[model samples]
Target chain A: MAEAPTNPVALAAESTVATRMSAPPSFDVADFPVPTGREEEWRFTPLERLRGLHDGSAAATAGGSVKAEVTTPEGSGVTVETVSRDDARVGKAGTPVDRVAAQAFSAVEKATVITVPAEAVLTEPVRVSVHGEGGVTFGHTVFRIGAFAEVVLVLDHTGDTVRAANVDFVVGDGAKVTVVSVQDWADTAVHCSQHNALVGRDATFKSVVVTFGGDVVRIHPRVTYAGPGGEAELYGLYFTDGGQHQEHRLLVDHSAPNCRSNVAYKGALQGADAHAVWIGDVVIQAAATGTDTYELNRNLVLTDGARVDSVPNLEIETGEIAGAGHASATGRFEDEQLFYLMARGIPEEEARRLVVRGFFAELIQQIGVPDVEERLIAKLTAELERSIA
Target chain B: MATLEIRDLHVSVEAEGGPTEILRGVDLTVKQGETHAIMGPNGSGKSTLAYSLAGHPKYTVTGGTVTLDGEDVLEMSVDERARAGVFLAMQYPVEVPGVSVSNFLRTSATAVRGEAPKLRTWVKEVKEAMARLEMDPAFAERNVNEGFSGGEKKRHEILQLELLKPKIAILDETDSGLDIDALRIVSEGVNRVRANGESGTLLITHYTRILRYINPDHVHVFAGGRIVESGGPELADKLEAEGYEAYTKGGGVS
Candidate 1:
């Protein structure tokens, strides 16, 4: 399905700048012209480091696969199945908007679909652990949650592979969904993926994306409202190390009236040539009256030769909106904050840990899962100890 | 008894042109249980003296000798100086977002005491200390000075002063911005420490108002980036009556 192209006449009549992204959504790999690193969306990404995920030269037969294991609570009544490409619910949530996603859709042999019935409140989170075994992989996943249902999903990615995938959430009206996706891939891995959420009327969807490893990892998360009163919250945390490139791009499309969306992403970069990029784009269509939106991005540069680029773009087509705002800041470790803590008898190393931990503590608590929170904290501690030492 | 002795302390800070000297030569010795008020006009380098003693990286000790109980203080790092019984309550306390007051205090105490205090006793200690300062217990969970008002920042500094219990405590214009009620409340906390006779106090101020609440045994008149006049408590009385015009009249920058 090709996304409807923007009408220049309508744009002129509405007197609003064109905000529809240049590339239209499609499930065919041939729709997107090959990017030469000059395209706005491809500028910050190192196309070469993608190892052919962009150009389709990398053989999909790299002799390894991403094995997935799903654990459902007893009597949870959640059904997880591997279905063919013709599954009716597969593309209902989202379609490919970029070449990598289209390639993933065209290359995958099977798709995984998870479903929950209406009004079911889950006491335990559905855990999906995907392990890559050193290969080229393309995949697709869809989660369909029924109306008024409450669900928590955890997607844990590990191991080494060159992979491109698309994951979508089809939330029903008045349903609430929380998704925590952790990308702790190996250092040799190259990962590029897209995540989409179609929030239903009066529904709430929250996503936490944590990235720590991989030579080059780029994730694009896009959210669109299915009806009025829908809400979407996107939060992310990433740590970039020496010779690593991590980029996170987000889009929140307020296509319905009376919807809300928020975005906050934080990253810490260290070592020579470490680069982290954050791009947040929000569009309030003419019909999205009474919308409320805000976005924030913050980065901490821990060492010399590190770089960060943060950009936030907000476009409104209607004058009747509740509110909109954005803020972005990238700073070195504050000397005064460190000095203040050291003067209070905290050693230099401990002081550094305190400030870095404090920086992430706010977002970690928002995950709402104690087990994941503790594990992430432990992972952060190990990372800090290594960096400081 | 602990003794903090400073002799011929000269400090300079980096300016646009070159190194500009802030403290020409400061000499003082504060012994345990002694409260010495160093009153001066603005830009007299009183805060410089405080920061230099606490080993602020911004200041260079061009020529100086700072010792505590005959041990070289100039040789220690900031945290070492802190653990070695030296504390500076900054005039403008730095904000540490996401670090709770309780966690900060407990961490500082652990570093100073060389071990973590028993959790039960530590909570009790913090509760009692906050009560005495008329502080709400909820403040403990609040971030360190993130959005605290003027009086609240000052009170937090004093809270640390009492909780950390360093041998030599330097208050850098801590009374600069406080209401009368807050002034009395803060002074009472200082007086409590002074009465205990466990730590020496170096009170830096631009006004004589706080002197009424916590009496000083000695007062030094600071001007021209150094002390020009030294006297007993009578010196504070004189400065209150006449002001520092007597000291800054002759080519000395105020």
Candidate 2:
């Protein structure tokens, strides 16, 4: 199979609308068919909350500098450009996501395009920091890793603001990409983000999203293995405190043969009104022979009023696959695990934090970038300290 | 110094049919610097005795007094007993994924010793212990017992026993799955623990191969949920020569 051209004509057609770049991608909710709330996929998603998104000046109100910087073992890099706008091409993704649609438009209208040079192996990471100040806002980023290259991208969302962010990544053939997004906003921030990745042939892509700061946080993360032998792994770790609602929905599409995809997500929700939801869908196509895939979602709900809902789905259309399996579980901390740690003289709180950290550490170690892993650890520990506080 | 005594012990397990007494009216005592070997055939309750001594939640002790250094061991939780200087090298150690052996040993050591060891000293101790057991030092980073061979698992048990020094270490069939090389290394580790002079040991085995390196001060024969015979080191040799056929044929009742 030949590699996808540097500039695909189909993708180029959408770029022509760059001239009509508006303030924000505007779409009347009535322009699209109303989901009767009957679709199996849309059943659980709160449709009413989306009404608050539409007809609101939230997207236009988004104005703040996202201090984007990239630091590697070698040195730091500068931000090339930050594009914040809604691209109509993203809305035609043929997916029924009421939340993603408005956020996609709002994100495409305001996107930060960061392009790493072709075949350039940057030893350092490219950091894009998105900062929002007061009102409801949106931020988006498009990261393109050139073919046969390696790069680490860290998206740090901070500041005292309630906003939504979209992050899209395109990994070229034989390229290796590691992306770590730290959603560490102020406690009062409302963060809704989308993370999408397209991995090419023989390419390796890893995404680690940590949601430790936010009021109502939802991450729509999707990964598509578009070429054979590509490997895609997505890991999400979220720790919620009191009165926080965090949801993570991930979709992995194995479109080509022999591609491998794995998802391991863990979250801990504590205190009153703490709620978390994890939805994972792994689709193995008919041509994806010899595809080995596995997904596991484990959540710990520590408090009487806290709730966690986990769903792991494996949809295989072909029997020629090598292996496929998924597992999901949500509950409070294991007394046995806790006791095992406490018996070691680790105090109760320290033991619980250790277990939670260990739970997410398993996924963090899979991120493959030492810098990203350290940042995640620092961010996660900071959140843990605050939660225990 | 220290002493571990089980007086008139009665242990029962909830089997498919009902509760069946596993250890009945068994009395044993071992003082510091002494190693006691309990040899028995299948279903003779040798492992049950070890579990009962370690306070495994599965084994219910109906009547017994298990005292470690004059402290009631049966009254303690499994981990509590361990913290109170009681260790059980499980016959079949459970494989825990995502938890490294070194991490588990550190946690266990901290639990038993009531504080974390100095990082430099702890690393040195773990390396020295693993080295003493003929284990690859790299094994410390591998998941606890996950994907380990039979000999490796048994050695891992010995690894914990060496790290978590106890007043009385109960090794349930430690020699069951070990190869001659692994068996020798495990025996050496056991001897090193005893060399400290502060820890007694209960070495449970079906064969006497391990007895060559570490001879026990006392040998007890278990048959039908009770210790039918008690003798010195030669008894182990006699049983190794004739097998448990003679003991069972003698028809000792519980």
Candidate 3:
């Protein structure tokens, strides 16, 4: 059961959470103090709009307003369980890196664990849908895959509420997994989440994060390899409309030898006050010999008064790595492309639509889900019509 | 029969300082089923003429009146010009990422035809057009003009020319950056369209090599942004034998 504070103001007055820290990040809420928009990690984030998730001012009440439903494929040898916070497998995948994530870890009483057996291949995708019924909620979910297991997981968020959650993914040796997380909340909702993935030896992990709705949404996805020969691919696509704030922060750590990582994220912003931010970070340690990594971010401003901030950072301690590079570009629709399309007899409005559809087509096809791809295309078309209208 | 009439055309393009004149008081006309070859040296404003007729935004028409079958040509928008039966085969076709050639051709056809083509016949039409261009069938699925070789791009332009079937077609340097084989193939496509006897062709080029393939009904030697000489087909042979130096002396129009 989840809880909500009756008087938010009183809770804020009683809370004495530290607002500064000079040490490394830890899972404990007290260890990593609440951010006051001064820290490097929290500089871009709007502290006041967090709904008190950062500080312990928003106490939990037994409301259970957010409901989560998990559906596994039939005969896939998958099991789902609800365990206490003290469960041994709770924090094996990753530890929290920020105060909000730490607070989420301390708030959720029961954590959901979904496990796939070793050497099992799922023919159908597993789906987890979380629907918000109002109020505030905190959640934690863990996905554990055994050695050589192959699975596709789809996590969907919807409805209107304030939410702070943490999701952990643990991939065993030689396992292959694809996770598609979509944030399609109501226009009045606010969501903050941190996703951590740990790839085992020779394992392959692919994560696709698609954000389309929500008032203020921030998602952080981080990856780290436990052994050599592991490969990770991170892809993201987001659309921000008027008065919406969407942020994506990603990190890939290559600590083991011969590991590889590639990241590409693209976003389109429209209308006034639409802001989209992307931060890509790749760190290659001294022991990460033969490490190869590349990151790219592109933003398309569809209309006036929209802003995008794209930052790509790479740190290499060893020159022995294979390769490391990054690129960032932000622009509006190219006039040349518009002219080319129009010179062929397509009307101005239709040509504009086609150009934008083409911009997102490449990434949409990479999703590999036919139904989901079609839905996204339809959504994008509707969004384009709204912008024009 | 359709007639494209140009009267004292004057065009200029914006530069760092101000508006720089490109086409200065030029006049040309083409009747249906006629191929008019405009040959000139570099910087002779030959391409500017082609672009001006197609109504490019970069080239401003300061003083000009172009009429296509008695309709104002300069007043129409870029796509409106295309729908009104005016086509331009650009020298450097732009690349449109994520848009397949098949989709682009169909969309263009739909806009010009005012309705979607029948699925069964449209597929056959595309297949036949690609085959006639000697293009591999896989190219239809590739992005429009993306990573296409120079020859392939020219062939693609021809493919559109054959499909769109506009009343007036302006080929701007269509022969440049092409090998002998590609030149022959592209020329044959143009010849096929000319054989229809329903569209007028305005071919702008720097060399007379392509004239050997597609014999023009009229030849115009352009110098100093205006036509210096106009004659029959033999004028091309004379110009090819003797370069434009005879027409251009002391950088003055003869």
Give per-residue CA lDDT, model 2, range B1-254, as digits (tens): 88999899999998898988888889999999999999988888888898788665678999979898788988876667777877778777765556777777887777678888899999998898888878898899887677999999888888887887788888888888788888888888899899999899999988898899888999999987778899999999899889999777755333
Ranking 1 against 3 by DockQ, winner: 1
lDDT by residue (tens digit), candidate 3, B61-124: 9997999999999999999999999999999998888899999999999999889999999999
Candidate 2 per-residue lDDT over residues A1-389, each given as its tens digit: 12332222111223322211222222332343444445444445454443334334455555544454544344323336644354432322223244444554533455556667667778777777776566666555667777887888887877766565566677788888888887887777667666767788899988888888767677878777657898888888888787777778887777689988888998888899787788887777677788989999988877778878788877776899879999888866666555544433345676666667776767888888887778778877777787765
Which residue runs of candidate 3 sit more than 4 Å off their true CA positions? A1-23, A55-64, B246-254
Model 2, docking class? incorrect
Task: Give the count of colliding residue pairs in each prediction.
Answer: 0, 18, 4
What does candidate 3 score on TM?
0.92
Q: Candidate 3 at A139: error in angstroms?
A: 1.4
Question: Model 1, A29-56: lDDT tens per residue?
Answer: 8787776888777788889998888787
Find the candidate with the highest TM-score and give its number. Answer: 1
- Scored by CA lDDT, what does every candidate get? 0.88, 0.73, 0.86
User: Looking at candidate 1, what is the lDDT of residue A281?
Assistant: 83
- Clashing residue pairs in candidate 3 are A3-A60, A3-A61, A3-A62, A4-A61
Residue A243 of model 3, lDDT score? 84
**DockQ for all models:** 0.86, 0.17, 0.75
